[model samples]
Target: MKTEIRFTHQSLVENSKSGDRTAQYQLYELYVDAMYNVSMRFLGVKEDAEDIVQESFVDAFRNLDKFKYESSFGAWLKRIVINKSINHLKVKRLPLAAMDDNEYHLTNEDEHEYQNIDAMDIMKVKSGIEKLPYGYKQIINLYLLEGFDHNEISDVLGITTSTSKSQYHRAKKKLVEIINTL
Candidate 1:
């Protein structure tokens, strides 16, 4: 017989913790489609994205009790999806550049350069990012766009923290070069 599903946040958590099969399925169904979109943002391949989404849901479910509602369920699920995508890429052994302790700084005057930049200018910069090589693109996306710190990036990409820092520098340089060409 078909069962009814209640979607309240509290109900889902309580039922999920109690091993209610129907509620578990309901939880998965509620988030899978949205999580798949999140997965696809990192993993462009259709099947790979789907696989990441499924793995994320499984992982999320396994740790559901640990979810303290510090963030919404959707946010929690999105993290899992993103983590899965990073792990999937890591398995392919993408040649990650190592970072050094040297801090590369841009000139202060140029630092405020985007002050007058409008939406189109930002879009132009984003378009340039798309042209970067895979390694550069991912580094920029994670370190700059996603605001991940070097240590976090190093762990995610399975590279040294110094490597993460160096790759970020290279990615920024390449991005600026691309934007200048446009």
Candidate 2:
């Protein structure tokens, strides 16, 4: 089922790359909702998410020629959307702090603290994440929800890998605290 969908999506992308207007519209329709949700997760504002999604689609179509099939087109488009969202956040002056590598250490107990987080209600967890400070929320969203590893996150957010790890840990701890309060 998934492979067939990918093949159809690939065909649509190829047509879009060739400047086929109908195919481009179809491709936009296919991805817009998911991309909007992703943008919403990052921005937490409907207006911002809507604007970013529109901008991201325009940018994706304009740059479609540069895309290779190395990864799925959706994944490629998603990267563009995420980057745009992050750029938007940066423009808002959201301070993503860099941590000194020697300042904090990760331990087994810290890992254990997060292990049971999955048992919480999804909506509750999401609410907890939303209450986090901007930097922690971004790290939690990128790592836990978007599945970006620390290295990729560091690259995207212009921080060190150690900072990413430390932030993620702090985010988790904060999220747990938030959940407990609720």
Candidate 3:
């Protein structure tokens, strides 16, 4: 038998489910910034991220009855924000996967410049990710930062699992190169 996992804020969820406006507002306040950050990571624009996060919260609240506590409310809300962000990108004709074999071409003038740098810190990594192209950045953000596996990424991006795996590997290689040059 399976059981629903209890959430830390179970009362808030339950109250919100029962049409309690105050509980809903509290839940929104708790998650808004985090969800906005998640959308920003994908969409990379302040206004778009804000809109996506707001829409995600509205959808989550309206469909509160479908949330069975199998996952934390934060986790469920995060998925909503991510999905909305990706859809926003798709509607705007943004790239989710690198085209062809673009990640394979290196622009270094000499082989001596390939020295590996190991002084990676959070700020450096964050800046490096920001410098990545849209496709590579999405893969890195999803697979590395967001902790999504290839299968989940494939499902989210509507691609095959092999494509997701390959894209993630290529994106990681590009990210490492960028970090080294930073």
Candidate 4:
């Protein structure tokens, strides 16, 4: 079933690449909301998210020919959107700090301590996330909300893997503190 859906999506993408306006629109309709959500996760501002989504789609269409089938079209498009979002943040001078290797290390024991956060109120957690500093917020959103692992986060943000892991651990701690205060 999943393979069939992917083939259908790929066909639409191929048609769009061939300049079929209806196929392009279909692809847009299929992915706009998800892409919009991805933009919103990186950018809290509605206007910024909307602008990035538009820009991402335009860029995606323009470069459709360069897209190879190594990954799903959605995955390919997501990479484009994420890169655009990060670039937008860079333009705004959002500073993501690099951490020393020895600054923070998470043991399995420490991981167990934070598992209780899963039971916290969703609204409260989201509010806490929004209240975080820009750098911390981005790391948290990429790792926790967007399902990117530390290596992937490092690549996306142009930080080292160690920095990504350190930032994520610190961000999780800070988020807990924020949620506790609320």
- The 10-residue segment of model 1 with minimum total lDDT is 111-120
Candidate 3: residue 74 lDDT (0-100): 98
Which structure is stronger by lDDT: 1 or 3?
A: 3
- Spell out the clash pairs found in candidate 2: none
CA RMSD of all predictions: 3.6, 3.8, 7.0, 4.3
Stretches off by above 4 angstroms in model 3 are: 1-8, 98-119
Using TM-score as the yardstick, the better of models 1 and 4 is: 4
In model 4, how large is the Cα lDDT of residue 129? 92
lDDT (10s digit) by residue, model 1, range 13-63: 778888887777888888888888666656667999998888887888888
Q: Candidate 3 overall Cα lDDT vs. reference?
A: 0.82
For each of the candidates, give the backbone clash count.
3, 0, 0, 0
Per-residue accuracy of model 4 over 53-160 as CA lDDT, tens digit each: 889888999999998899988998988888899899999998776568789999999899799999999999999999888889889988888789999998998888
My TM-score estimates for the predictions, one after another, are 0.72, 0.93, 0.84, 0.90
Candidate No. with top TM-score: 2
Off by over 4 Å in 1: 1-4, 113-118, 121-127, 143-155, 158-166, 179-182
Give the Cα error of residue 16 in candidate 2, in Å. 1.0
Q: Which runs in model 2 stand beyond 4 Å of their true positions?
A: 1-7
lDDT of each: 0.75, 0.88, 0.82, 0.88
